[model samples]
Target chain A: MKIAVVGKGGSGKTTTSAVLARTFARHGHDTLALDCDSNPNLGISLGIGEEATEALVSVRDAVDAGEEQHATSMDDLVSRFGVDAPDGVRLAVVTAIQNPEPDCP
Target chain B: MRVAFVGKGGVGKSSLSGSFARVLAEAGERVLAIDSDPMPGMAFSLGLEQSDAGLPDDAVEEYEEDGRQRYRLREGLTGTDAVEQYAQRAPGGVHFMQLGKARGPQWNNRRQHFGFQRLLDDLPGDGWSIVGDLPGGTRQPFLTWGRYARTFLVVIEPTPASLLTGRRLARLAETARAPRVVAIANKVREPGDAERVSSRTGLDVIGSVPFDPALADADRLGKAVLDTDPDGPTATAVRSLVQTLQKSEEQS
Candidate 1:
């Protein structure tokens, strides 16, 4: 089933969500944990080493850089970017925007 | 059963949320957690380093491409396929994705659709619990998603603003047809604080937590309070919250 944890800043939304994700992963079910917050620190809670992930490139950036067309087809996105399932659990990222400041170590 | 934990700012919702999840995991329950807030500092409280999962600048595309809403990001990521490649699998067996940040336009449309919600169709089976950490405000995203949740937990404080919002949330939940609504009092120091808030707001108090400096210190140092103080008052309160909710669900 799906569960969502939401609260104000300093109210423990991220901590609760991250811990729940870790706890679920520990329980051994194929689970997907998502950190869709603007502060962007869910990767750190999961013990990821760096802030860099190939999953972050955006369609807007591709267009701004002239990497794609003004109206790229959805089929083009799947063919060029999507990949087969990976080892362990599956992790995905979705957001409306990125941070102006770098949130890396 | 699924559980959604929601509250405003400074209510210790994150600590309680993560701690409750830890309690369930220790008891052999499969739990997945989703963080939907903009600040995204819950990582430190969950015993993980502080880092971002995705970059917002590239995640969503905003153009009225056609009659349908089309979005694409990450040159090598999934498109229109209803899934993205930026999600990362955590060590504890949970697969995680980044909702990153919302642009001003998307934030304005917070009442609309959260692209992440699409993952609901891809969740696990029964006996699994999922928790999401949301932002501080009682805006459309929380209210809208609150409608979809089977159980809604509102975090409250003794202050008028907090209690007022808590009650408003309860009414909204009732209006939206949430499966269940419960309130939690965080950092309760004054006697009858929860009761006072409840009596004035006319909402049931299902949980309470005491203030602790250890939690604040952990936040400053970038560490999980569980790792620092598992037996602390806040932790114990959170564990009890899990048991209480689990029992409530069982009885239901």
Candidate 2:
């Protein structure tokens, strides 16, 4: 099953997503938690240590900086960018644009 | 005293900005609360009945800038004029304006976005104390939505996630050459909560609003904490925050 947690900032969306993902994983589901927020912190909420969470490079940054090639498929994306969180949940951060250029929507 | 409240999502940016604007207005300062978040939470905090209303469609006009389609405020309208013409009147006489809210699957606030940006760029005079409530995370700050403000209030809670985001935002503010950046610790529950936030984010804690049940209750009831409990802990703390801000502005 897929779930998307959405809310305004400071509304516990990350916390809720982490809890739900962990719960599904413990219940024998192969869960994939996607941190799609520009300020991604789902790794921290999913029992990943702060240092490791911070060290997880986002797919967009990695690809944009030429550190890694863009994944050609969903499976490739998972294997290339996903980090192992607690309870066997595969976590991947999509993108985080730290500094967007002006007039470049 | 233009200020923008920025922090991680759910970190009380709206709550503080809304309350601060009202309190500032109550003190006889002309306040314009600008909500740049597409989610539009400032109206609720400002105790305004209209939650989804934004700048009118006529507020913007199509134009070509650098051979690209763009939107700007209709000619003959200044940012101050936009406020006087379209800003909503909230409790305590605070004038509130918002970049349009997201209506559906597609982001439908483009016109409002460009229009508000243009308005902010052309805001006239120093008569109004602008309090801008930016969207959560680093996206808006990185995009320079808060560039107009003289100060950036990076609200943070005593949590790892909040601290990380706050630290990132503070750094971004500095990189953007913001005149001043300070942290306002919110939902501080423990004795060391404020200190922890300060240390973690590397920002001086200007004021700390305690974790108050009244605030939660007010949020649950879809009301502003100040309206629900005017003399409550959160309100009192916010009031003190206003005073600190004003004093610092005077000195600076």
Best by TM-score: 2
Q: Residue B159 in candidate 1 has what lDDT?
A: 58
Q: What fraction of the true Cα-Cα contacts (under 8 Å, chains A to B) does candidate 2 also have? A: 0.52
Candidate 2 lDDT over B1-252, as tens digits, reads 799998888888888899999999999999989887756578888987556556787889998889998988888988889889888889998988876544456656777777877887887648889999887887856455777788889999998888988877877666666788899999998999999988888899999999988888887777888899999998899899999999999898
Per-model C-alpha lDDT, please? 0.57, 0.84
Can you write out model 1's per-residue Cα lDDT over B73-183, one digit (the tens) per residue?
434433323233443334344333334345565544321133444344334446456665555534433344433356777888775546655755665555555678778
**Candidate 2 pairs with clashing backbones:** A9-B9, A9-B10, A10-B9, A10-B10
Q: Predicted candidate 1: what Cα RMSD to the true structure? A: 19.4
Candidate 1 chain A minimal-lDDT segment of 10 residues: A96-105
Per-residue lDDT tens digits of candidate 1, residues A1-105? 698877546556756766777777677866665545532344444554223332444444455567566447855653343222222333434332332211220
Which DockQ-derived CAPRI band holds candidate 1? incorrect
